[model samples]
Target: MPYINIKITREGVTAEQKARLIAGATQLLVDVLGKNPATTVVVIDEVDTDNWGIAGEQVTRRRERGR
Candidate 1:
């Protein structure tokens, strides 16, 4: 079994987009690793910008500075 974890900022991602991400990850394992789709697991984690950070700053602050 293959376990894939995906994390993204919780910025109003649509259900369809999440579904596509899961499907794409599963398909990638199936295509590249020859893993069974039924045995593949994909988890999507949506985190608040404040909880996610980059370059010594929170994502929320980064976005604010960019704007």
Candidate 2:
């Protein structure tokens, strides 16, 4: 079994997009590592922009600054 964890900012991601991400991640494991799709697990975590940071700045602040 292969487990994949995906984390992203909670920025209006649609269910269809999340489904595509899951499928793509599952396919990647199947293609590269020959993992069984039935056994592969993909988890996505959406965090608030205020909780996500880069360059010592919160993502919310960066977006506000247009950076």
Candidate 3:
């Protein structure tokens, strides 16, 4: 079994998009490593922008700067 964890900012991500992500990740593992899709596990975690940081700046602040 393969476990894939994906983390992203808590932006407005649609359910369809998340479904696509899960399917795509499972397919990638199947194609690349011959893993069984039935046994693969994919988990997505959505974090607050304030909790995610880059280059010492919070993602929330970074987006604020861009706006």
Candidate 3 off by > 4 Å? none
Stretches off by above 4 angstroms in model 1 are: none
1-67 per-residue lDDT for model 2 (tens digits): 9999999999999999999999999999999989999999999999999999999989999999887
Candidates in order, TM-scores: namely 0.95, 0.97, 0.96
- Global lDDT of each model? 0.95, 0.97, 0.96
Worst 10 residues of 1 by lDDT: 58-67
Clashing pairs in 2: none
* Model 1 residue-pair collision total: 0
Q: What C-alpha lDDT does candidate 2 achieve relative to the native structure?
A: 0.97
Cα RMSD of all models vs. native, in order, equals 1.0, 0.5, 1.0
Native-to-model Cα distance after best TM-score fit, residue 11 in candidate 3, in Å: 0.5
2 versus 3: better TM-score goes to: 2
Model 3, 1-67: lDDT tens digits are 8999999999999999999999999999999999999999999999999999989989999998893
